[model samples]
Target: MSIARPDLPRRLAAEALGTAVLVATVVGSGIMADRLTEDVALALLGNTIPTGAILVVLIMVLGPISGAHFNPAVTAVFVARRELAAADGLAYAAAQVLGGLAGTLVAHLMFEHAPFALSPTVRTGAAQWLAEAVATFTLVAVILGGLRFRPEAVPMLVGLTITAAYWFTASTSFANPAVAIARSVTDTFSGIRPVDLPGFIVAELVGAFLALGLMGWLLAPRKPTTVPVATPAE
Candidate 1:
């Protein structure tokens, strides 16, 4: 089956727009949750659901355009797999980062907060890094596995995986570097400290590479072996 590959400009626009909406959903939900409740757990729940739902919507709407790679780590994996050109992948990453920042600004405007503020949320340490690695590994694995087996279900698979990871991981599964960087400018429930960004981004990249390596082999088609037929009374 032939898939329609849009021009580079349109693909980049889709990526940027999709990522913008995704981060806006994340940041806006987090701010709203923080204000609506004193319980941290409840606020987290509020943030997780909207983020997941928006991922589903965004991927469904934009996947056909740019493969909906809102995360730089994911884009890198595709480039490594030879599915996307290096230049286009770089462009996608740039758009995603800019879109993420724009999303943060939009969320802040909606809540009447300052345009940009450094986050003081201290999220660091070995445990946090390990959690990020695991979260990103699982996220990439889910994407690859879904594409391998059920191309139609990738959106739901990603959304559900992220929703679950939000609760399971220590750093709340800031699995996407672009989103993590954008969140650093917000002092809200979903924000991470700028100082800790390196660890998370490195871990995410490591995890993505690991998943690509493992899934590349695991999902490959196995050659069928022919059994030698036994001669009947020969």
Candidate 2:
């Protein structure tokens, strides 16, 4: 069977655009929640539920074009697993970052803030970094685990895992590096500080790499048998 070589540029653009919408919806909901709710839990529920649905829906819409990797960590794992070519990963990551930046700016406008959220001096401390690593690890594991050969369900499962991570994990689960950066631009509930970005990114990358190693061990091809039975004389 012949499959057309995926247009890397088109896929990357799809990633960028999908990620932008994800960030926009997530952050915008946060900003609105901060205004309406006094309890942090309630505020977070408002942010995560819609984001989860959006992820599932958008991936179904865009997965055919982009493979729907909105996170650098996800793309990195794809490369390590030989699922995504290296050059393709690079372009997708670049596009995702750019889309995040644009989404943040637009979110700021919507929230009636210039900087949106912006990171603070103590923004995202050690606890947050640890949280990010764990969160990203869980997300990648679910993604890799749920759909080893079944590409059709990747989007929904990925989104469900993320929503569950947000519900259970600390730091409200920043499983996505690109989304983390976008959150920094908004001063709203979804925002993190710029100072915190690098640490989060590093942690996410590490977790993703760990998942990839596990995947390699579990999914490696078995060695072929050398011995064969002799054929009966005809």
Candidate 3:
């Protein structure tokens, strides 16, 4: 039941490494899916499965090290909750974002494509923005709920939630702001236009805070009552 506490450097390394692989899983699978299939639905299916699978594995492997928070949004929520210190959270966020960029480059190199190209995939619209919000909200909700009620099951829950979100949300659930920013630089199957990044990131932030408030309210313990037990006070 007890795990050895990793030092800050090790924890940050785990976060960076885990997030890099996770982003690679996403972008790599999408590239492979696109190259291997003509059906968009099937390609998305291919992309979704591996991304979710890797997420579960990464969380299971690195959860104890860095809480496996590959998303800045998740880190922010934890910081707000006092579960993570602000400085640590900032480091985790930086590592995740940098790792995501590295992952995108890795995927591009694997595909024999030029890296650091701005995405031309325009994913802008009101419905898309709303979808981003909903997807992020649900993701944070699942994370919070799982951590609260079933800590052991958080990895699987998060993976499944993301997989489902890919299918349900119009924006394909780019729920992580780090991911949204990283994807903007890759002109690949999983890429999004740089212009669209702001809307998605903002929506994700809004959704994260909304979920934080909702989970706090929903999971808050009932306050104990004080009974009047005065003896001889007249």
Model 3, residue 8: C-alpha shift (Å): 1.6
How well is each residue in 61-102 modelled by candidate 3, as lDDT tens digits? 999888999999999999999988999999999999999999
Q: Tens-digit lDDT track for model 1 on 59-159?
A: 99999988999999999999999999999999999999999999999999999999999999999999999999999999999999999889999999999
lDDT of each: 0.95, 0.82, 0.93
Flag regions of model 1 displaced more than 4 Å. Answer: 1-3, 231-234
Would you list the clashing residue pairs of candidate 3? none
Best candidate per lDDT, number?
1
Question: Could you give me the TM-score of model 1 versus the true structure?
Answer: 0.97
Runs in model 2 with CA error above 4 Å? 1-6, 115-117, 121-123, 221-234
> Can you give the TM-score per candidate against the true fold?
0.97, 0.88, 0.93
**Pick by TM-score: which candidate is best?**
1
- True lDDT of residue 100, candidate 2: 84
- Where model 3 places Cα greater than 4 Å from the true spot, the runs are 1-4, 224-234
lDDT of 2 by residue, 1-234 (tens): 977856877887899899889888888888788889899889988888888899999889988887788889999888877888898888888899888887788777877788554656344678877888888888887777766677788888877877888877667887788888887777677777788889988988988888778876787778998998899999
Better of 1 and 3 by TM-score: 1
Q: Between prediction 2 and prediction 3, which has the larger TM-score? A: 3
Residue 62 in candidate 3 has what lDDT?
93
Report RMSD (Å) for each prediction in the order shown.
Answer: 1.2, 3.1, 2.8
